[model samples]
Target: MALTTKVAAGFGGMALVLMAGSGIASAAPDDSVIVNSTCTYPQVIAALNAEDPVAANALESSPMANGFIQDLVNTPPSGRQAKIDKVRAYPAAAQFSGLIAQVANTCNNY
Candidate 1:
């Protein structure tokens, strides 16, 4: 009876752990949802509008005025806005500002 109880408890714990892991996996964002720039600026606009309202407003307010977005558009590698993704992923404000400066300099001619 004691051995059976212990086995049942162990199985219960394992079930809980598996449930938690599956929940975490489901909660993770899907990378495929991210729209690539080559899809068209309107698609980028729609994706941004759906995913980030504040950033989308900033873009809509002055799409070209945003140095980072403008830079990515003007000198896009592979004609895509991958640079914006790099800038958006910056964890710190200082790093983002630095990227903005770099973009400005790189796109100055445009």
Candidate 2:
């Protein structure tokens, strides 16, 4: 993938992460703590672990992807979709969408 595509996908993932709250709310632990906390790398890891240990472990395994995720979470939520839409023309759009949902689900639960 081009660097542009990778960056856009990162943003899409972030947007999805932010938008992922609807499905798992009932089963999830209280994430109110997230509101006051900054989305630091360690904090993000903890959040993912709290909601999805497998995903968290996977994240912990990749330092570069972890940094990318840290950047994504730090991004303002309002601008994420536009970034996502820019990459919708790519053939990987469908996969990007799926990735967004998965990452968002992980992030949103916390």
Candidate 3:
């Protein structure tokens, strides 16, 4: 083959490899959070809203979140609002809050 043809082929292969790697790197962090029997996204939202531990448990088997909901639900009405504000303000949990908010709005889950 001509040297030019070989050079072009080499660059094309490198580009394909780089692009595939970048795609893998850019993928959502939750991609590894297996969805084994996980509830449909909508069910997740509904369970969250209802704060039904049984329903939430079945939805995602996310004990921590469901447990939080249970505590929130059991809190006095006046205190629950503060708890919610704290939850939304949680730095690490903020991304999830934003995602849920976007989903809720787009899904017309209002």
Error of 1 at 98 (Å): 17
Candidates in order, TM-scores: namely 0.32, 0.41, 0.33
lDDT (tens digit, per residue) of candidate 2 on 1-110: 75445534443333332232333422122222222234555555665567556545555565554655666556554443443333334443343334444434454344
- The order by descending TM-score is 2, 3, 1
Model 1 off-target regions past 4 Å?
1-37, 63-110
**How many residue pairs clash in model 2?**
2
For each candidate, the alpha-carbon lDDT, in order, equals: 0.31, 0.43, 0.33
lDDT of 1: 0.31
**Which model, 1 or 2, shows the larger TM-score?**
2
Model 3, span 1-110: residue lDDT tens: 43333322321111121111222333223321111112344544463455433433332444445445445434544443334433433333432333333332333332
Query: Which candidate leads in lDDT?
Result: 2
Ranking by lDDT: 2, 3, 1
